[model samples]
Target: MRSISVKIVIKTFLLVLVFGIFSKIYGQTDLAVKQKSNFWKQVQFGGGFGLNIGTGFTDVTLAPNAIYNLNQYLALGAGLQGSIVSQKDYYSSAIYGVNTIVLINPVEEVQLSIELEQVRVNNTFRNPTTGIVKDNFWNTGLFVGGGYRMENVTMGMRYNLLFNKDKNVYADAMMPFIRVYF
Candidate 1:
């Protein structure tokens, strides 16, 4: 699982790099002619939705955000996120988080983004040995990541760089995301 995740990340980064280079070469003239807009006109609304289902596992996530275009090249935004996950006779969990994001667009269609997030997770586990179920304590995580962006949407991956394996509710080293803008 880890190897596959790493491979995907590498491929994504490479694709972004190639796209950036090509855009720079062909889109330089387009950058000089910047379109002017008002503050409200520069604001955008969007978010992400995800669902995963398997034989005995299910997860759903929804994140909504608002973005302000600072200029032709920079943008800032904030958002809220909520998620739920469950596994048959195993565990069920709920996650909530707040995030702030910064995006840089070197060209019209290509973007780079950095995001910081604080998340709280609550979990309930079923102990097979004791045939009992108990609720675990709440835990918080701080995550950061950078990724490639596109017009009206972004496809990227993130990781909890500050997580402690023993205590952190999030175990995945890399998580992919798809966000849309309206």
Candidate 2:
């Protein structure tokens, strides 16, 4: 089960990396063509990463997003995310999701955002007496929060309003994010 979890994580990471590289190349070409225009100038690339390590637990995440500016105050975007969590001699889990986001800037350096996401998660548990158990499910999440926006970077925090306490993979807690745009 542990080997399976690791294989899933590796495959997901590779797939994400491949897609990201392709997008970057395509975006560069698009930018060149729109160099003299202002419409393409409004598009931005950004994402967030997380890592945690402890005595017997570890969590890692990677999320990448692209945004299109609709106006001075509003922007829309889409993102893809993958995460893995492991606990020594306990459980290992893999999660992946897709999200659509809307961001509003009411004031300079301040941003408000809302996101809807659909996530799929797989968990493998190792038990002392029961041997092993595996579970897989899909869930929906609605997130609303605010953040600090800068010229080239943004930092934000959000809470999932629709988080399910019983079946969801993510905890019903605040999540922090940082993104860099080009």
Candidate 3:
């Protein structure tokens, strides 16, 4: 009688094992199909704008960007920038640029980033004696930095690897930045 009970128990376990193996025969909710449908959920959009007006001076800027998060540790993105600046009759300029960036997260609260940017600059300088002088040029910058992150916001400082004292737009190679994403 004991031997008969052991045989019945073995048969029941084997039946369950076979059913579990064949449960996905329909082949619809598999791993590859789920990942393909969820691709759009990984994209994030973010950017910033600036406006400053003072005595004989006006400056405005607009920048917009988007990023695709491949995973928790890596992200890639692109951005566009446009700025207009005028200071009385002394100077005026229009600046436009394109930028590409990569971000790496070493931990949940810290991130490392690198970006490459190229901008076209047009300057109109007016001197009472010299009249109007127009200067057009291109400036390229490679910035590498890190930041502290809190949810969708990050604040940090970045140093330009290609900074030129005579022709650069920024006053210093080291600059602070704030980034937000939604």
Candidate 4:
């Protein structure tokens, strides 16, 4: 039973890993561009992969989303993101979230943006001594971050705050992405 469960978990993780890689590759493709009445726009949609390293755990996230430019100085978009992490107690878990972004361009070569995200975490912890499943939880929180865009690449940093009192943990992470607009 334990072996089967482990196999299932590993398979799920692998699927998510493949999805993340493909999303990044597709985002870099030239299909992300959009055309308007009189203009050729850069990417109106984007996605990327991110790695989060903490004290005793590391997480990989596959985030995909779309952005609509409201104007030259403003944009709005949302994404669906999932994460797989290796935790301290030799247990692994997953989380899914929705993210929103705002962009501000001050110069032709530099673009600044802010992202806000809300996520739900489903975690399970097992006891090493007894092989018992002792901890399971559902959590939600908000994250805020900013990014800088240079040509086709964008880099950003953000932190997430776990809302539950029992899981009031915060995560600080960085993301860098490259996208090609058709």
Which candidate's TM-score is highest?
Answer: 3
Residues 7-85, model 1: lDDT tens digits: 9999999999999999997676555444333566898999888899999999999999999988989989999999999
Runs in model 4 deviating more than 4 A are: 1-43, 50-60, 86-89, 130-144, 159-170, 173-182
Root-mean-square deviation of every model: 23.3, 20.5, 9.0, 21.9
Native-structure RMSD, model 4 = 21.9
Candidate 4: lDDT over CA atoms? 0.65
Q: Write the per-residue lDDT of candidate 4 for residues 32-129, one digit (tens) a residue.
A: 44334323353376677779898998989888877776776666677888888878877777777787776666765556666666666666667777
Report backbone clashes per prediction. 0, 0, 0, 0
The lDDT of each candidate is 0.78, 0.88, 0.91, 0.65
> What lDDT score goes with residue 52 in model 4?
85
For model 1, how many clashes?
Answer: 0
What local lDDT does model 2 show for residue 141?
Answer: 86
lDDT digits (tens) for residues 1-182 of candidate 3: 99888998888888877876676554545766778768768888998899999999999999998989999999999999999999997999999999999988999899899999999999999999999999999999999989999988999989999999899988999999999989
On a 0 to 1 TM-score scale, where does candidate 3 land against the true structure? 0.80
- Give the residue spans of candidate 3 off by over 4 A: 1-37
Q: What TM-score goes with each of the models?
A: 0.66, 0.73, 0.80, 0.55
How much is the lDDT of residue 118 in candidate 4? 65
User: Superposing every Cα of model 3 onto the true structure, what RMSD results?
Assistant: 9.0
Q: By summed lDDT, which 10 consecutive residues of candidate 2 come out lowest?
A: 170-179
lDDT string for model 2 (1-182, tens) is 99999999999999999999999999998987777477668889888888999999999999999999998799999999999999999999999999999989998799898999998999999999999999999988888989898876779899989876898866655788666767
